[model samples]
Target: MSPRVKGAVLGLSAAALFGLSAPVAKLLLPSSTPLVLASLLYLGGGLGLAGLEALRRLRGSGASGREARLGRKDVPLLLGVILCGGVLGPVLMLVGLQRLSGVTSSLLLNLEGPFTILLALLVFGEHLGRAGALAAGFVMAGTAVLGFQEGELHGDVLGVLSIAGACLAWAVDNNLTQRLSLKDPLALVRTKALGSGVCTLVLAWLTGQPFPAAQVLGGALVLGFASYGLSIVLDAYALRLLGAAREAAYFATAPFVGALVAVPLLGERLRPLDLLAGALMAAGVVLLLRERHGHMHTHAALEHEHLHVHDAHHPHAHPPGTDPTEPHSHPHRHEPVTHEHPHVSDLHHRHKH
Candidate 1:
């Protein structure tokens, strides 16, 4: 499949997995504190992925040579990702889930998409075309519509603000993660999940949060494995292919998936405004999916290592023994060339528009 199509599949799949977590997490909330639940979720995903990695290596099925390793230079960015996306984002989301209905909380989570896109454009040097810009606006407008809680100001306000905070934290995570998307996705996400999980678990203990029941603990771990662990790995691949701005547009569908599950699983009734918000967000997603971008751009001489096949941007020589049939990673250099083709803000396409 083409890179763009593959990226969309990975992104939408990640969204579905993550979207299922909200309502189910809400169900698990009564049995566990937010801190503890968040801890297990991360730990679950981390350990689960770790085990899979170990198993892959044991079977000699590992693709380590096909992916780049994280270097010391990546430490700071990885740390920030763990803190914002792994720790702060989940805790705040759970806290907000406590105050709001599952469906509302799910819909409000749409803010993360617009937040990530804004950060990509404003702070991270990514550009969006007109349709993409209008799509983001529609998403934000839908989020605003969901934020209006008819008559319950005091209760809903905190929930809205808390989720918004979570969105901002995750937006930072998304952009930073895109910067590190060239590294091995499994290793990157595992490190993030494990580090953040341990830190949050320690904090939970210090705060006197009790251990949840055995069953609840198991459930949280399993949920984390699927939602947090596998979902993030998929998202990293999407980021590598699509760039942060476009990936955010695809990932934004997550809230809709969650909202749909919430109504049935949580037995929640959707208000008319909720339906309207869904329509707006859906329209935005459709626009994003159909959007196309291409132009004349220059690729300056550069050196980097990442998994790739010999495409237009990568027509470099390789060692005698290197396989040319499949994607592989090694130190490589690019000669200066100017050309035009459809592209997003991927690693090779970050040139100013």
Candidate 2:
């Protein structure tokens, strides 16, 4: 399959994996697992990834070099990402899930996409045109409707607050992950998983939750590996092939998937509004995908080679004795430019001459 198709599939798989977590947690909640104890599931997932990565390295199939090593400069940022996404996000989400209906939490969790988009725009200067704005609005409205139907407006305000906190923390983690210079994809996943898992496990132990039964602990380990570890790997691979916007657009399907899975797995029922919200979410995704076709530009950066054919009528001068630069001139032409910074090397620039 093509890279784009692979990316889309990977993204969808990541969403499905994430969607399963809610129902799985609902099943395990009967064990009276404290939120902190549940958080260890995430930690277990992280450690599982770390172990797999280590095994992969041992087998000579893992990423290597400086990119694979955590440096002093990355420590603070790594800690913060772990704290927010690893420690706080899951803890709050588990607690909220315990109190809220699985379906309700699934729908409310849809807020992550819009929140992520807004944060990307405001904090990272990512472009959000009118189309993106409209998409965001659609998602926001759908989430609000779901929230109202879920009775968050009249329910425990603190539970709502906790879920909101999880959303924000995940948003922060997403943006921070994008900003980091880490290039070894597996290493990045390992770092996130291990770092977050360690911190969360420590907190869980401190909270005095009883050790899970061997069977439950084994289940949690498997869930952690699939939901956290493999899902992240799939997501990273998808993001590498599909730009964040496209990957996120596809990933946005997670909430509906979660709701659907909950119906069968957790025996939860969805109301008409839930279906309506799902429709809106699907529409929003269609809009996001459609935007890609509407806007097509060749984005080239300095220090990279780009080849394009220009027609004869383009009216640009070529080097002496070379073919004239035209609208449809050469079958292929090469252009290369240099930039000072590695990150800026891929930045797009328009040619004047």
RMSD of each: 3.2, 9.0
Provide the lowest-lDDT 10-residue window in model 1: 146-155
Q: Which stretches of candidate 2 lie over 4 Å from their true place?
A: 1-7, 62-72, 90-110, 139-152, 155-163, 239-248, 293-353
Q: Tell me the tens digit of each residue's lDDT in model 2 across 182-216.
A: 34556667788777777777776787766767777
lDDT of 1: 0.83
| Model 1: colliding residue pairs | none
Provide the overall lDDT of each model, using Cα atoms, as 2-decimal numbers.
0.83, 0.62
Off by over 4 Å in 1: 60-65, 87-110, 146-148, 155-166, 320-325
Residue lDDT tens for model 1, 1-353: 76777888899899889878878998976767777887898899999999978886778653553688888989999999988987788778877978877657755776787889989988887889898888767766766675556553334889989988999999999999999999999999999899989988987887788898888889899999999899989999999998898888777767667777889899987889878878887787777777788889998798888887788778888889887755888879989899888887787777887
lDDT score for residue 166 of model 2: 87
Could you estimate the TM-score for every candidate?
0.88, 0.70
Query: What lDDT would candidate 2 get against the real structure?
Result: 0.62
